[model samples]
Target: MTRSSHSLRTRDLGYAQRVCVAKAGKLMMQTGQLTPRARVGLAVSGGVDSLAMLAVMAIRRRIVPFPVELLLLHLNPGFDPHNHRPLVELCAGLGIPAHIETTDFGPRAFSEENKKNSACFYCAWLRRKRLFDLCATYGLTHLAFGHNADDLAATFMLNLFQNGRVDGLSSRESFFSGRLTVIRPLLLIDKPTIVRAAKAWELPVFSNPCPMAGKSMRHEAETWVRSICAGDKHRNVSLQHALGRWQLDRDALPD
Candidate 1:
């Protein structure tokens, strides 16, 4: 279908919102995370960030220079009393194809067999492995995640304080010998902007179902980072960049 036809099916998110979306798309393009005819799988978790990312990506495809295919992929962590209807409905409304599957990652991570590793680590690893498998099976060129600037800042702090290393999130990183690349178009965008957009755009966001929600070490780090960046967005951004450089330098060192 033509761009105009596609636009007709999706709601007009207004100029301001469109600008936000365009800004994210531009950032991805500048970083080479997005390219013409790229096939991307969006790893949506039904949270505010992921939901907004999925919508923005779909909208981006309709307006970009060349045709790009997008597929929404959601892996349910087998949390009881959870519903994916909102996500499904949103994808249907946007005319985007989605693949939803349930998994025992959460349970397995919390089970007795998970004594060696923390539940968070095991669950994330399992989910990531499944995502990579899905990308390979579906012929996806890249996998897009919804991590924003705030997430980057928190991640840097987590690595430094918890792991005693300098590391930060990357905007784009290749995986499995470059068979599939992971991209974060929203990396430059802040969480507040994403939260506002999710509300303003009425994204079908849902709360995270993981039992460790708001209680993980990452959560504690994020809270601390949030307090540190209380009224200084620039500080948060600067910290990420500065620490990210240190990480690069660290990686360059010889063992």
Candidate 2:
């Protein structure tokens, strides 16, 4: 990339970053996910989505009223040995503390012994468990994921179609008896916006090394959703609004 082009890209990314931080900060305040002086861990997967989340969080921390100590936590599933260095370097450049863990979850999940469990399912389960363990070990209050509006919509569709329920992902969820919380600050942002930001910022986005990257049920749901929304640009917006209202209604019901 040339210097002039790089400068323009940085300028564009600065604008995108500002928008992301503003939206994310508002979500954080409304959800009350992060408290002042709280330590939060970002689950960085070296992908565009997670990298964008990392950038947004870093920017939001400086501008928000409360103080949040950000930490980068990565779990290398041993799919690609060279996949994690960019994540570490990004954390270093951001001046945040980072912890990277390696495991053979990828290989093991794809092994013959685990034929019953899909590779995608097994990998996700192991990665999430490892993240929870990391939070417990490091005393982090919250773990932030890179799940966006598309993911939420896709999940909603998956549940509605497969499980016969109107369930979807939540922006904030408590686990382990409220000892730890999982938050998704990008719930209101769409994948296209994230992709633009990632490209503008020149993030070192890495591809998923999993053999079944595009063969998962989630991917199928995404494709279906896109096909449904092909002509109507407002379809996703409608889905997000409906999902939010449904969640609110569910929350209001008696327990």
Candidate 3:
């Protein structure tokens, strides 16, 4: 890429980032969960999704007409001990406080003791438990995740096929009798949009260190869901609406 071309690409990416942030912020405001003065714990996993979520939330905090404090939280999962510095630095650059917890959740999940459940299941359960504990520890009013619309659809299919139910991921779920709310601001944003925005913003997205990174049930479900959507943005959004998880306006995209 030539210097001018590279600069143009960067500018386009910056515009993509702005659009993503605007859509995310709009969805968050629609949910009415991210209130003023809310202390939110953002779960950053070093993946493009979570990293992009961090950037979107950080930017939204600044431009939105509210005073919300964001804290970046990462659980190392014992797979890589030295991979958290980039996330910490990113949080620093965004002027958000970060808390990194180094745990052996990954290894333990694959241990023999965890025989019944899949490693992904065990690892995710433990990670969520720790995140919830951190939220309580920090007295955070909300915990934000990077799960997007595609995740919601795949999860719905996963549950329907595996458990035989209509249960799907909720955009806003309350926990601890409403003391701490779990919010998915990207719930209405599709995965491709997130990928594009992440690329434009040049987030420090690292490869998944989990041994079963692309070999899990969830991965299979995601692949199947992608094929079902077949790169159609409208199909992706319609699937999310059909799952009854989101009530977005017809003009979902920001002008």
RMSD of each: 4.4, 3.5, 5.1
lDDT values for all models: 0.79, 0.80, 0.79
Candidate 1, residues 97-204, lDDT tens digits: the string is 999988889999999989999999999999999999999999999999998777877888899899998678777888989888898888767777788777767776
Ranking by lDDT: 2, 3, 1
User: How do the residues 1-255 of candidate 2 rate in per-residue lDDT, one tens digit apiece?
Assistant: 432124233244566655666776767777776888888999989888898898888777766787789989988899787778877666666778999978899998988868788888888899999999999899999999998878888999999998898788877888999889889888767788888877766778888888888899999999989888888988877877777656545433234
Clashes of 2: 0
lDDT of 3 by residue, 1-255 (tens): 322123223234466676677778777776675888999999989998898788788767867787999999899999988888777656655667999978999999989979999899999999999999999999999999998877878887898898897666666778999999988888777778889888867677888889999999989989888898796978867787776444343223345
Can you give the TM-score per candidate against the true fold? 0.86, 0.90, 0.87
Please give the TM-score that candidate 1 achieves against the real structure.
0.86
The deviation in Å at residue 144 for candidate 1 is 0.4
Worst 10 residues of 2 by lDDT: 1-10
